[model samples]
Target: MFDAVRNNRKIVQIFLVLICLPFALWGVDSYVHGGGAGEDPASVGDTKITAQQFQQAWRQQQDRLRQALGANYKSEEANTPEARLAVLNSLIDQRLLALEANQARLGVSDEALRNFIARIPSLQENGAFSMARYEAALSAQGLSQPQFEAQLRQDLTLQQLVGAVGESSLVAKSSTDAIMRIEAEERQASEFRFPAAQYSAQASVDAAAVKKFYDENARLFQTPERARAEYVVLSQEALLAQVKVADEEVKAWYDGHKDRYQSAEERRASHILLLDKDKDPAKTKAAAEAILREVQAQPAKFAEIARSRSQDPGSANKGGDLGFFARGMMVKAFDDAAFKLKDGEVSGVVQSEFGYHIIKLTGIHPGKQRSLEEVRPEIVAELKRQASAKRFAEAAEAFSNMVYEQADSLKPAAERFGLKVETSGWLAKAPKPQDLPAYGVLGEPKLLKALFADDAVKNKRNTDAIEIAPNTLVAARVVEYQPAAARPLTEVSAQIESGLKLREAAAQAKKAGEAKLAELQKGGEDKLAWSATKTFSRLQPLPAPPAAARAVFQAPVGKLPAFVGVTLDNGDYALYRVAKVSQPEAIDEARRKAVEREYSTLLAQEDFAAYLAALRARTKVEINQKALEASDR
Candidate 1:
């Protein structure tokens, strides 16, 4: 089917039109019919949006979001009601555009479609179209070349309507100039903040008020529901503690796999390196050749020459010694030259990416097989791990069934498996996910949820065995359950008093700041120390809360030193004195052009939306709300 679609463009184009008859892309059959045979997710005019089409679009949207968020993507972030509605609305818009294009008899030329595909940045390499890259991109999306082109043609036809509507949009030069001037304007201001702490001494809370607040919001003082549990864990590590490997078994395994104990040969070498510092490769090569000749003449003084002349600071300090390393550890040219030289023998000038080098072979550690005594501990450990893993695999199914069939206590399973019945401290009904790590196996989300189930908490029944990790199972039962209760009034009174004082202090600070602002606005005389005046703009604002910065820009500038007040996010009141306002003297032509482009694009989008709205009004659309919501599940 894929080969045939790739071979015939006309046949693929026809196939594309026929395949989307009952989907978001409208066909002649859909344009004449109201809906498909079965109930559909939505319908724009007479075209039905099929469930399969909705699912495909939904999955595509999911992929786009995952790619955008990268590692930050969360499973629960998708499939929200708002996300589903956005997808459905997108499908409706596509259906509307397809219907309009069909009615207008719009079409894209074959050459035009080919040009669009070739110009795609992903399909190009070295600034030229690459057939291999284009084919791989299509293959990644499970699309054939002809099928992709057919779809591209339909999209290009719809773009014609978009272009027609956008061409009708007109942006005014006056509006662009006014917005540009506003953006370029700057304001100077001085700030004075009234800290909430200054009013703390004056805030006196009455005993009656504190009691009333405590009574009204008692839930805040209640203790959470928690339980203590007795649990048993069946894991490979737990089984490994019981596994003992015999000396005979270790000997047999080591003898059978002696090749695994062979250690690769390692070489230790020293080198003097010279790098091309002045972008003159010939000068560096000459310097390296001179050093090589010096070392060759005085063989015993190689270390002395290397220390004085080598440019590699790391190895030069230690007489140009590079510690022992196995093959393939260093650059290819350097590694080959170092290994080819005999002990204490120096090589001629060798060139690598770094520049030039002279290498000396110092020591060689040949490959060798280990004796039985040297690797006995390692062999014993490997044998025990293998035995434990096999034992755990066989016991896991029986463990799961035993816990469920017993269903009363973890004792039966623990005794049968020679495991300990561990006890937990108080655990909340729903502990924070991050805090679960301290509980070990009990921290696993699935196991924790199971342990806190109502049946386990109230009835004191063992939870069904849950796989907490690979080859690890856990079953727990509540030994002591604590119902939700309230802490005593006396125990929480001090906390309530501290909170009440802070709230009252913030209120008093705001009241005082407002009075000072009112007096200043009335042109009254007052002395308030202000921070150094700073000039700021919408593009570059003062280092303060957004509300404080906004107060500076929003103050009236008719009079010098106008005052404005705002309560900040941290519960402090701030007042600003607007000293001066100014705008740029000359217009920047490049900046003007950029702003004009942005303003024109906004106008074009508005015009296109209006045209789409006019078309939607003339068409009949129906949506299945129930089916749309059900699809999320």
Candidate 2:
């Protein structure tokens, strides 16, 4: 999880910005200007959320959602007015928190920021900080060292404010006990289902009722506007197909960057760890030194001593063997000692963060560089990629211009770029498939909007080239069009009639189930068939009829058999007769503790939410409606 957080820096940065919003200031004047020269989407207190900043945040949210929903995700949903407004509101909340944090004089120090950055696993190599990798990652994201550091500092400062509120929350013992009692309660019950299918055979839907239902819900039967189109794409992948790396170029690259193919030396070592564990440092050190002295005198006993006494669980069972590791894999003190010792030699007691350790150097592997022949394919691919990138830079401008200039068709642009004008199957305004051939760009809201624009559709003209993805441009022209229209009643009459009959059946089932339940409550036994008794609890639920299971637990326990009725999802109605109720004799301590921790965490979250709400109440928040709406456009 930590590696994922570090590798997905863009997503993590956006999440930090959002989570830290409540601790930043906002400028009222920025919001008033509203997406103008130096305008903001909203403001809290006196800090402004700039248009660029808001846009980056919105895009980050879209990316996060896309990742979560996978192929089912749609970019068009995030482009809506409501979605944009939600993003703006989050920015406002962030500004409110920022204002409060600033007034409290909360801050993160330079040393703390450096430490935090150094700890990111993705920015490290072989478990050690690597400055080159860190710089390269930031450069890839278009952020400088100072810019990234400043954001990190801001995030840490906001964390301080959130921590204070969350830490103050306390869960009462009485509340914990009450919740556990209910959660542990169990009940046994029998149920009878009044299946709607039984009633449907007797119920009939008339023409008038079907027509009324259809007329009231006409919008549901309307077909969305659709089009068939021809499009051309200009992308790096497309350009790569036309790019070639000569043998000489590949050889030259390999010669100039031969050092990149070299691997560092690695060593395998073992150690008996004596963890600090809040014990006296001197005592811990003395114990480790005793083991070290014993091992030095008789190294053969090292493995037995490690298995019996080592505190490091990860390696203790393996006789403290850490396996093969590079220079930077271990902490500095431990790494230095292990590297200096000869194979089969043991080092004196050394102190580190985890306390003292007795090191044993077991094996060593020397580093080597690969020959040219071994890396020729890699060199060729790298060189080819570089060539294609250069070509894309030069051709992108020409592609964009050609599409706009030759507006009638994609043929001219396609021919100029040595590309084919691909045709697509019928596509809805909001295309269902994200990977639709030729019309894949229609999955993107902006391109779809442009393709269906009045002039583009009516004149059958090509759209201006639009970047649907990074370094990928697409332009489309409508070949066939269909306007939005409602499906006639004749076409949907059967569907409406079926729906009306189901509704009538459901009504009959509910009536019969209620009558049966009343009869049961009045001490009258009906000939209705009841399922076998089943036991359930909040923690252990029944397989079917969850509503009946829930009703069993909720039914009154005074009578010998308590009765309740519920309408099921599949148009069936269920009547339950709860026969028994039981409570645990005693709460399991471990389970109770787990539940307590969860309840406490929930309470802490509530406290944090209340704290933010209070900050908003105290501060003056201004949202520029026009600017907020314009950001969506």
- Candidates' lDDT values, in order? 0.79, 0.78
Q: Local error of candidate 1 at 498, Å?
A: 2.1
Worst 10 residues of 2 by lDDT: 1-10
Best model number under lDDT = 1
Q: For residues 1-633, what per-residue lDDT tens digits would candidate 1 score against the true structure?
A: 022232333322332232233232334344446656445788877678877778878887787777887744544556688878878877777778778888888888888887888789877632335576777788997878777777667766766766676666576888888988888888888889899899999999988888998999999998888888899999999999999988899999999999899998898888888878788999999989988888888988877887899887668878888889888667678888988988888888998766688999999999999999999999999999999999999999999999989988889899999999999988887776676656776766567678778888778888988876668889998999888898888999889998899898889899999999999999988699999988878767456777887777788889988899999876789998888899999889897866766666556656666766887899887789888877887
Q: Candidate 2 lDDT, tens digit per residue, 521-568? A: 899976767789877777764755776666777788898788889999
Q: Which stretches of candidate 2 lie over 4 Å from their true place?
A: 1-18, 21-161, 244-246, 264-367, 415-418, 431-441, 626-633
C-alpha RMSD by candidate, in order: 14.3, 7.9
TM-score of model 2 vs. true structure: 0.71
After the best TM-score superposition of candidate 2, give how far the Cα of residue 478 lies from its true spot, in angstroms. 2.4
